[model samples]
Target: MNDEKFLKGKVALITGAGSGFGREMAKCFASKGADLVINDINMEGLEETRDIILKDHKVEIFLAKADISNSEEVNNMAKKVSEKFDNVFLLVNNAGIDSGLYASLKSKEDSYDKVMAVNVKGAWNVTKAFFRQMKRQRQFEPIRGKIINIASCAGTENGINPFFGVYSASKATLIAFTKLWALELGPSDITVNAISPGVFLTPLYKNDPKVIRLLLEARGVKLPIDKIGEAKWVADIALFLASPTANYITGQNLILDGGMTISINKL
Candidate 1:
């Protein structure tokens, strides 16, 4: 465990923080002593996350219930964050949706739109609203900001999975933006990166061993670790990117696929 309070005075804004990676990151950041601005469309989940964090950490946690897909809502939430904190040092665009197991021909257009709206445009909306503050902070801070976008292994051309073309494309878009923003923001000392995780035992998997086994067997997939990933694993990477440790890294997509992506047979 990192006992160093590296982010003691910094403020972090994380979207889709109600559960999964977002929730896990919130807990980790708070443990590192960073104040939090957590957002989610689901109020119950948001409150649950807040409760979990408050149990062990005393950092300030502000909850915002907003849909990241809605530009107006995102802007409004960002306004609240700006009002509460003078500057946001970290931004995590972790809110994303997956279009469940439907063939390309059978998938609904609305499904595609929903996935794109939250996964792609949602990330854009949050980043644009908070970037201004990050740029302004550069005038006085050594490192202005850090942005971590939660992408997926499915986004890579060679990492594509069956029946998830829309979700994959949406994540690919985010990956592109991660690199583009790193280029555009690097001059100002704002590092941007993406974490592309493969199979994780998140709520999506329901934490059922039978379901996981069935899915892996059905897809003929094999992982070197021989198990699904944990949300904490991804959160740990986000912490590294947001910390001063990754000062020189930028515009990179860090794949967390448990060696699945490197397998020729899986590819």
Candidate 2:
């Protein structure tokens, strides 16, 4: 951990913090001295994440178990956070889901609705509920608020796999929102940005690494790094985006694809 503590005295809210990128980001933010408010639909997973953070970082952690897809639930969670912390300096919209391979085609309506609900609406609900507090914080305090959306590289790619169409569309929606929100909030000094990651070895593949490798290989996805990414890689980027260093960078989609986007010929 860096001793600089750039995020000292800040409060950060991370969605889908049960595991994967969100979990790692939570840990990274906590290490920098920010108090945390982490939420997930999975209570057990949320508890595990809280315990892990508590073990290493001494920052306060508030565990909220709420399904981000539900607007009412998300609004209530936001109220709770505001009541507890009064303001949140960092908001990481990291909750998302995807229909299993080929399932999007088989169950188009269900898959599309589910993916959109969690990925698109979930981000909207949380942001809408917290935007006022963020703006207020910017006005009264010296800190600037940040909203980091976790989009996917599939959103930017022109020719995506049909099996991932719904998932891709949802992420694309989020990327669009990131730009729009940045424009709307820039005047208030609230920076909004999106992160489009290519392939990261998170808990999603703990059970079947070979399957993921074959999927990427079949797509002719070759990166200069010649390896998949880690959750820590994404977490580090989140840390940078949330820190003061990223004050001037807004409305940009920072693609952390290990040069894969430029290396591979577009399909």
Candidate 3:
């Protein structure tokens, strides 16, 4: 961890902090001396994340348990934020669900609705909840708050991805929110962006290393990047976007697939 502590006096709210990108980003933000408001539907997972951070970093960690897909729960979390912090310096909407491999026609309507509820509508609710605090800070302080949406490459490209219809559609909707919200929040000095990751070796891949490699090879993803897309890489991009260097960058989806998307398109 860097000793500079660039975000020494800031507050970052990361949804889905129970695992995956949310966990990685929360750790990174805390290492930079930022207080954390971590949310997840699973209380146990959120506790694990909080414990992990507390062991290494001394920053304050608030466990916000809420189902982001539930608008009432999301609004309550926002109220909790108001009662605790004056402003939210960074909001990362990482609480999204994947519908695995399924064709649109074959998949049930409930599956589609569930995915949309978490990935698109859920993110909207969280962003709207935090936008007030971020905007209010802009009025009295020079807070250039940032919003990061964790979308997916399957959702980004125009080309069709086999068996990922509902999941892709949900993520595509999130990317759409990133662009539109960035525009709406720009004048208030809040930047909105997204990270579209493909082929990431997330915890979702529950298998041995060799077995995972064989699975990837069977699927034809023999990329030379060793690890195609690591969660840390996505976390790093989030940090950079939240930094002063990205003051002018907004409404853009930074693709973090390590050329998988490009090569597929070219080939």
Segments in model 3 whose C-alpha atoms lie over 4 Å from true places: 1-3, 139-143, 158-160, 207-219, 224-226
lDDT value for model 2: 0.85
Tens-digit per-residue lDDT, 92-197, candidate 3 = 9998887877876777889988999999999999998888788877533454688999998878773247657788888888899999999999899889999998
Per-residue lDDT value at 160 in model 3: 44
Instruction: Find the 10 residues in a row with the least total lDDT in model 2.
Output: 156-165
Reference-based TM-score of each model: 0.95, 0.93, 0.92
- Which lDDT value does model 1 have at 217? 73
lDDT of 2 by residue, 111-196 (tens): 77888999999999999988888888854344469999999887776425564677877888899999999999988889999999
Compared with the true structure, model 3 gives a TM-score of: 0.92
Better of 1 and 2 by lDDT: 1
Candidate maximizing TM-score: 1
lDDT of 1 by residue, 92-191 (tens): 9999888987765677999988999999999999999998899888543678999999999888866766656688788889999999999999999899
Q: Tell me how far the alpha carbon of residue 255 in candidate 3 is from the true structure, in angstroms, after superposition.
A: 0.6
lDDT of each: 0.88, 0.85, 0.84
The Cα error of candidate 1 at residue 159, in Å, is 1.1
In terms of lDDT, the best-performing candidate is 1
